[model samples]
Target: MRTIALHTQTSEQIGLVLENNDVIEYVSTRPEVRTLSGSIYLGKVSHINKAIQAAFIDIGEERTGFLKKESVPWAQTSIEGTLKEGQSITVQVTKEPSGTKGAQLSADITVPGFFVIYQPYGKRTAVSKRVDAEQAEELKTWTSQQLGKDEGVIVRTAASKVSTQTILNEINQLRDLWTRHIKANTTDRSHKLFDDPILPDQLIRKHPLPLIKEIVVNNSKLGQWIKQRYPILAEKVKWVKSVSTYTGISINELQSKLIQPVVVTEQGMELVIERTEAMTVIDINSHKFKQKSLSSYQKLEMNKAAAAEVAKQIQLRNISGIIFVDFISMQEKKQEKDLQKYMSGLVRKDPVSTTILGITRLGLMEITRHRRFSNVSEELSAKQKPTFSKDTLIYRLERYLTENTQSEAVLVAISSDLYNHKKQLLSNSISSKIPQELFVRHDASIIDWQIELEGSLDMIQTVISERVYHVDNLF
Candidate 1:
């Protein structure tokens, strides 16, 4: 059985897709720059380069957005002298900001609905390839008859069973929203006019409702929101006070498993995955079950098993960009072809667009997946790494103390390694600046870059109560 469990923390929300009690997919959204992909922004042209035909747009963010000539909505013949510095333009983010570069923006805007994507600038109707050629032609003809000369619609696969009126209504709603955004963009400069829906709403719009057996939420407010947003799934909605009550595992346990660098398959094979800035590499290792004698058939079976497991891991971890999979060497050409076909079949289950490039001469399989947000490894590295500099640690400590000024006394505990590294601070007179009976202790139990606070029992209880609440009323 497949189930989706939701848990929200601070400004972040997490969703886990479980199949047969095992997590197959994970998603996390936070109020941070990493989650700003696909948003429509009204930007001011900062600079232009005629050599590359690209312009820098200031979208009211810390970094500017990059717009290329090919992504402009204007006619190719009429684009000359159309854009200039100090001009306001409406652009949508096609790729997220990476490294020091700004986001990739496009002038052509497309709004997605439940059954179709509304394109105000487009002139032709398009249908999804998932539908049969005959049915797609029929859909195209129907869309062409219904849409105006300035409007176009791309039929989604979800519209296969939907009524004509319903599809038209959805398209109309999307067109209205797009028009509003465009109008707002023209009036406001360097501001966001429209953004994608929240996580649950996005999931509902993408997946078929019948496939989601249950929608479980840890908070009553969130559960109510889902029920109100998707009335058709009201009967399947569930409210749990804690995520642990719904899923056998807690959020911490699931997160720990997701960060593991090595995964072992049921066939006694192991996969070690490494991620770098340029690409992700997966190495297949069979040393665990290796014996004195091994046949070609046995090796082929192990490789095939690894193929399926790799696909599942890729989806669960949300790894994107160029991926290189190093498989066990096979002597026969037919075996390599067979393995590639099997891997392709497995990757078809992923929702993201993934293209499997043929194997290389060195037996490394190449793949590319489109990415919209930071993957699990990137998030974990930012949140869990313990390498704070001494100055940063002191700044954080001072900030924490300043925030809790009402406390009568405060105790700061840190790992021994950090204490030893900063022992000179004791003589530098920085420790004496702390006021209100502050105590700094070195504890081996704590991590190097982490700071622990101890307050009254009453304060701890209040924090816990505020975190976990009863959602029984949601049902």
Candidate 2:
């Protein structure tokens, strides 16, 4: 069982509540700030790079916003010809800027709430994927009647069991908000027209229902806002004086736990997640329970348990991209099938799309999940510098050059901080390994390096073959 506590703060007061480790809620006295996630802006195109197929927009920021050609509303117009420099166009931000990448913008705009998603550009009504056929049809019909043909809306998963009155209230609120934004747009050209508010309902809309037991907020105003918008959830809401008091833990302790290494266990097996990456690799090892007396069937059961745990880990960590799971091999085909079945069931619970390919010939299971935001490891390592040393970079470069035999080669060193370090080592390492006969000049400003070997095509092929072989051996 899990308990939830809520904490809120006004200009003068703070409140908190604590349930179990599973649930805690808090609020702040800070004024509500707008997030760019779903806000629509009329931006002016500042620059366009046809080579990169990207454009920069002046969205009232120091750095111009970025909009890739694909992200533009292609259905609306032929963007290649329609978009021009200094032209004003309606756009929405999909992702905030991080690092050197500018904020990601889209011509398509969507305002998602707990019970419905409002699409300013859409003409047809759609239903959430979680809703059943009956509820979807009914909701679609009701939304059409209430909203008319002026705008489009997608009924959310939370509306699965909601009443018509609740749906109507949401529609009215959204319509009013949209109207206000439209009015503001006519008068304001250099400021935000409609930035999304950080409301409790907005948070609940973003997360999956099964994972969120409850929400707790400390501010009476926020608490009232939640209860007014989601009367059904009012009973589950708890208010407290402060977030720290609500969680029964200090802010520092909460941060530590959130940032700590995650440990997963199932049956007699355990796996520790020290770090995560675009390609998450899980190394599995048997823990205790060596079956000397038991049959092969008993051993197979442990492998199945491990597979199940891997699936759970993927969801809990919100891991995506190429995942390599090294599972304990079972000789029997039946055992492998059972493990696969168990893994499939776990994947079904995940909100993100997932595909579980069976074990590779190399005895590795490959799983892929769709990625939206950065994975758990990236979020945690935001402050830490990379650990790759100068020695390691040199060793990698030398191995690459020795194994691949080709006419010309390009080595792109991406990171700004590592460019100089990589360039110096690469030039010296290649000169030492292949002798001065190879021409190598280090250019610091060049983001990438191209190696061209002037010789017979066959000789070029030989160099590439050798370099590739050497690089593979180093890894």
Candidate 3:
């Protein structure tokens, strides 16, 4: 279940609902915050960089509007041909600017809300894929009859169960707003016609708090705004007098907890997930599990549970791209199949879609997920706590070697700045166990070492043969 909560001021007070995840609640009375999602903009082009195939437009903010060549209108090919310095252009803000990047803009405009996307220049009305074919035809017929010649609405996923009048009303409202904007900007080439609403207004419009369980707010102005816009949310709002009260702890105490270790446990095993620029890597440790005491079936079951948990964590953290899961090897084919089935089931619960490629012979699972925004680590981590970590580097190397193996066995270990820590440890642990005559190589560029053994060309073939997986673990 997904629930959304809205908080006012600076303190994060959003709560997640346990039953249905789609609903979010926030406290804000500002009308600007309520409907800023589909607002269009008439901006002034500040600069164009033909070399980078990008342009920066002034949108009346601290940051500028970003327009890439690919985002330009289909009729416009080259930035040099389409745009000029100080020229005014109509652009739609796709995403808010963060960090060094400016707000993302597109020449193609789309006005999106809960139920529909209104395209000013579109020629067709389309239904959402989630809508059933029969229902879609009925809605289409109704919409066409009501809209007549107006053919710019694209029904969204939220329109599946909505009333026709509600969709039409929203479209008309958006169209009226756009008309006013165009009229206001027609003669004014030097001024910015549209600017994103302030943060408070944006929060109200884009973040729906009704679906959320609770909201915490620190700023009195914002709290009042919430009460004015959404009286229903007022009861659920909690006011935080100060930042300290908002965090539920003193600054010093919270700082102390930042450096504390995070311990995760499951089925007598422990694991840790570390962040990196390329991808997040999770390390599995048997920990207290006595060797040979647990059957292969039991061990595989435990690993499947662990994998499911990790998948949930990834979704919670909004991690994306390549994810590699290392599981304890099970020689039995049924055990491997069961583990794969369980893991896939767990992953299906995620709101975002994921693809689970089955385990390799080396006991590694390859997974990929779509990313709509930055992951949690990227959003929250500071400069001092850079995204890279020793654990992540080792796991990535292990995953890479396992997937990219050729004719040789690859052994990898991390390198240390002081006295060869990971290198010495890996060499000591596996050097005597494997063939001594194998080719060895040390990569000091990053934190890991790479060791390739001879006569393993057949290994890659075997690993590829065992692929059988799908994402259904969450069920």
The model with the greatest lDDT is 1
How well is each residue in 1-475 modelled by candidate 1, as lDDT tens digits?
A: 5677887744778887787888887878877635566678889989987778888999988799999888886746423366888988888888778789999998877777767888777677899887789988988998888888877788988778778887777776677778764554466558888777547766556555456778788778877877764555678778888777678867677788778989989977889998877999999988876554666776677789999899999988989999999988788888888888988888876767788998998889999998744687678655544576776775676567656656554556666676665554444433345443455555667665343334664554454357542211100
TM-score against truth, every candidate: 0.73, 0.64, 0.58
Give the CA lDDT, 0 to 100, for residue 88 in model 1: 87
- In candidate 2, what residue range of length 10 has the lowest lDDT sum? 10-19
TM-score of model 1 relative to the true fold?
A: 0.73
Q: Give the best candidate by TM-score.
A: 1
lDDT (10s digit) by residue, model 2, range 424-446: 65554454454223433344564
lDDT of 3 at 67: 87
Cα RMSD of all models vs. native, in order, equals 13.5, 13.3, 16.4
> Which digits, one per residue and each the tens of the lDDT, describe model 3 over residues 402-466?
45534354323234441144453354433334332222333456544443333454553343345
Global CA lDDT of candidate 3, please?
0.57
Q: Which lDDT value does model 3 have at 402?
A: 44
Q: After superposing candidate 3, which stretches have Cα over 4 Å from the reference? A: 1-3, 11-40, 46-56, 60-86, 95-104, 133-151, 176-268, 290-292, 332-345, 357-361, 378-475
Ranking by TM-score: 1, 2, 3
- Residue 171, model 2, lDDT: 72
Q: Note the Cα lDDT for every prediction shown.
A: 0.75, 0.61, 0.57
- In terms of TM-score, how similar is model 3 to the real structure? 0.58
